[model samples]
Target chain A: MATIEELNKDYSKENNILKKLTSPGGLKDKITQFQADLDLAVKDFKEKKKKKEYALSRNDRATADMLEKDLETIRKNVLDLRDKIQKASDFLANQQKIVDEKFEELSKDPEIKQKLDSILYKKYDRKKKAELNKKQQLETIKQIVDAHPNIQKWLKGIEGYEKSIRKCDKIIDKYKATPPSTPEEQKDLSDAIDEKNHSTKSLADRRSDLVDYFAKNHPEIDKNILENIHSYGNIDRQIAGCEKSINNYDKAMDNLSVAKDTNVVNQTSPSSLAPVPAQKPSWFHPIQRLKYSINEWRARRTQNIEPNPIEPNASAKSTFLEDVKLSKDEYNSEIVQKYLNEQYQENLHKVARQKGNDSNERGE
Target chain B: MENDFINITNEDLEKLSLEELADLKIELDDLVSKVNDMLKTCDDILNKDN
Candidate 1:
């Protein structure tokens, strides 16, 4: 039978083991997670193939383009996962190195382990709690969004209109071969023809943009458009509550009012459409304040000189060109071919001169 | 002479003709199938032991 003190000591050891095991630099860890996103991409590709084979020129092509965008998203997710893992590992290594150096420094003090024992490993636990809360909030917010009638109506409207666009493509392909018949048919044809004209950057292009946005690099874009795209369901909520209603206060309008007053998303990042700067992190690092300020000292001493890029040599330029439409062999051989042509012409001129000299000798 | 797997770059893959992607696609599919088979075998063993 263990005493309360003994139980506490046992539990502490167990927690320590878990901490060590899950630590960023541990032999076994959860910090470096391999993503299943590429597998999802493969599944998307397979599903797209099936749709292509069966759907022919059906309205499903729009859906197929969306699926391709989904594949791109999955690819970007895998890349992001890898990048995060690499960054975590690098940070862990740097911290461990600093700790090792500090440990050596602290060895002279003789009470280093006692000091280290006071520190608790609770950051991952806090991160987990935050994640759980965010997920719960996202679900709660999503329900609020789904309850909006306009959003539901708008989503439903998309498929029917998108179907019209796809039908237009098929009809244009067919109608071009055979002329228009009825007056209604002619009108439909005209609309489809217009959709076909400027529709290259249509729904699919916007979808691809979304995939790129939630992607690995997450390149910057027009915030308004990104917000509109991401908040597809949210927009529906806004419209149903505030702008679209019969009374002085619409449901869409009411939601929009709440949105303006409150920071809707705890809005943790710069990517947030509506930003609250109080919670914002500093753009530069802070730890330099506590330390000897290496950056400040270096800034005073060092010149702001940029390193020069290597200039390409004539031979290397001919041998290895970046994004050259022509191949290395073709470009090199073309130059050689030109030189040969010039040399051949020179030889012909020399031969004619010699013949004239021989003719003069014969005349003498 | 043996070649390491990492010798190929993304640019090389991009430059490959459709015929080349088709050839690599076959190889990638085979590798993916083998990986799936191995995963299933390991899962079965673990399940039985557990």
Candidate 2:
């Protein structure tokens, strides 16, 4: 067994690993801790159970309710913890599960078992080596910037978007004070705001620095692609990009005579909106037609009983019983008697003949 | 056994942070599980002798 100091040291090392890995996103540790707590709760539940069983045996109601309340709280906390941990795990990288494996071994081992200790130490040592260097961070920051060009145009678009957005907000506040906007009105407002704003997100303060080159230098791209590369700083360009299709639609809307005007303005096709008929499940009324003809053909061919139509069993039954039945009558009655008698007589005759020959030789 | 647990529960454990609570919970859970397991093992040893 390891000394108390040794055990404490192992525990401390595990704690340090956990502390460093503790990001708010990762619930791997939190859930592990919850599971540990849940187990204690189960133990407490068991203890409470023991008490309840004893009390019930003695007919004590008040004590049981008190224990039951404690148990209820524990159960609620356990359930809540499970939900929280699942949500947290979704957000975090699964790095904490590794830390948990080491923690479990170190905490559980009374003797500090050799294999577990070695695995725990190896994990600890590897983590110590992985501390990210300065050059790596700079490269990562650079890559983040270089990846998105639209991000620069986005930032410049922000100030331009601010005016329309503020107008939309004022409209929203007015709507809130009144009976509220209709769904169509709301959608129009949101779509109008979102069309420009969603693209401009790339230019927001923290991210804006990356795409500044678009706003800082160049009227557009290098002309190979011949695409108009606009700055995020230029929200006018962004509004125009969103408006281009809308402007075309508006022109189309205006060009329409009275009969065609609604179609152009609405832009949605009515034919595709109709729902298709639902097909009933096969089990409800087994389909009339066979999916494959091979099974039907084979059934027509064979003299033997038809194969069961249901899905094949995982394990087929053996033919050994049928084989045993076929062989039973022939081997049971006459054959055993004949075989035993013939063997006994042959041995008996040989022994008697040998004895008689020995006596005759002695007499001569 | 109830009294023993009552004493443990009353030992200022409620005031601790969730992380500290988890640590204490793991320790306690380990102890209880060990005891339950030990009880089963003792029963098995006695049965084996018979």
Candidate 3:
């Protein structure tokens, strides 16, 4: 059995090679290089044709003939380059498939699988921690905002305006429903319309005030809280990315295991190598049609059965009231600067922690 | 002619041990380098002045 140190070393070595094999500068680049060379050769042939024309204009048949021969050689070489490019492209595709398979095999090894899992887990763990921290911070913010009487009143006031606007909308609808038969009715309808517009304008103003209050009074707290709230989406994306990588690893392993089982079955039963006959439809039988329909329904149901996805933690569930959409101007306010500074510090701490983890893994 | 080259699939590679995979990687690297060199030579020949 390999020790942890030996396993780590082997994993790193193999991982590096795998990275190189898949890198842009690897075998794939050869095809690109060949195509580029072919383009240059074609361009050169065009220039040579111009030279041939000039030679002909001077009545230099020998020179013209020589240039034409050179052109023919260039044309032949260009064709050969194109052929090489095609071959190289096919070769790269074949090799890439092999490399991908090798990678899958490497990942399936117990030690390598553990190493890969640990790396993925660490990433997922970090994002999960960040997400939890953000949630807790948001909860604290919510508590503080909820506790404050003035903030509560302001929020209520904003809600009141929204409610009033809705009420005004109903009034407007009532006024709009009866077509004004007299000048007095028309004046009443106009007044109602004007009132609704006033309420709408006030609602906008009130929301803006609330935003300004947060920016001015609780800039740091509000910035951190709102920024964190906004960043839940980003963290979710990062976590999902990590999950996808881990899922892909598992999927590859599953495929390998399935392949192995199939191979074993094939080895055990030589008769299974023969293709099964296709089912023939009997149009004369109603019972057979019903059975076929039932089978088709079952197949469709099975196809529709998707695996349940991983759900976000309870803390990540946000309320409608908490989904505050910051305006462009507000997002770019002093709060943004504070948020950016806080993010920079957080990133620095994360990088330092990552470095420490790397060193610890290396046993340095 | 290309078919003459050994066509090792995923199944073939899966059966090999880790050490053999590593050795195979080295051989692959050497082959890739040779191909690259051949391409470079072809590029030079194409670009060469008469």
The per-model DockQ list reads: 0.01, 0.01, 0.06
Cα-based lDDT at residue A57, candidate 3: 100
Tens digit of per-residue lDDT, candidate 3, span A1-364: 9999999877665444444444566443544445445444655676798899999999999999999899878767765875675575467557656855776766878888554444333333333334444444445456656667775565555555655665566566876787777898788777777877887787667656556767886654445444222111223333343344444434433443233444433333323222223436455464454345445644764577445422323321121113323344544556444544554565567667777887999996
Candidate 2, A118-148: lDDT as tens digits: 3323322222222112122223333433576
Question: Model 1 captures what fraction of native contacts?
Answer: 0.00
Ordered by TM-score, highest first, the candidates read: 3, 1, 2
DockQ of 2: 0.01
lDDT at A1 for candidate 3?
94
Task: Give Cα distance to truth, residue A253, candidate 1, Å.
Answer: 45
> Candidate 1 — number of clashing residue pairs?
11
Candidate 3 chain A worst ten-residue window by lDDT: A312-321
How big is the positional error of residue A272 in model 3, measured in Å on the Cα after superposition? Answer: 54
Ordered from best to worst lDDT, the candidate numbers read 3, 1, 2
**Model 2 in CAPRI terms: which quality?**
incorrect
Candidate 1 structure lDDT: 0.41
lDDT per residue for candidate 1 within A188-246, as digits (tens), equals 78988887654534554544544453343333223333333223443333333222122
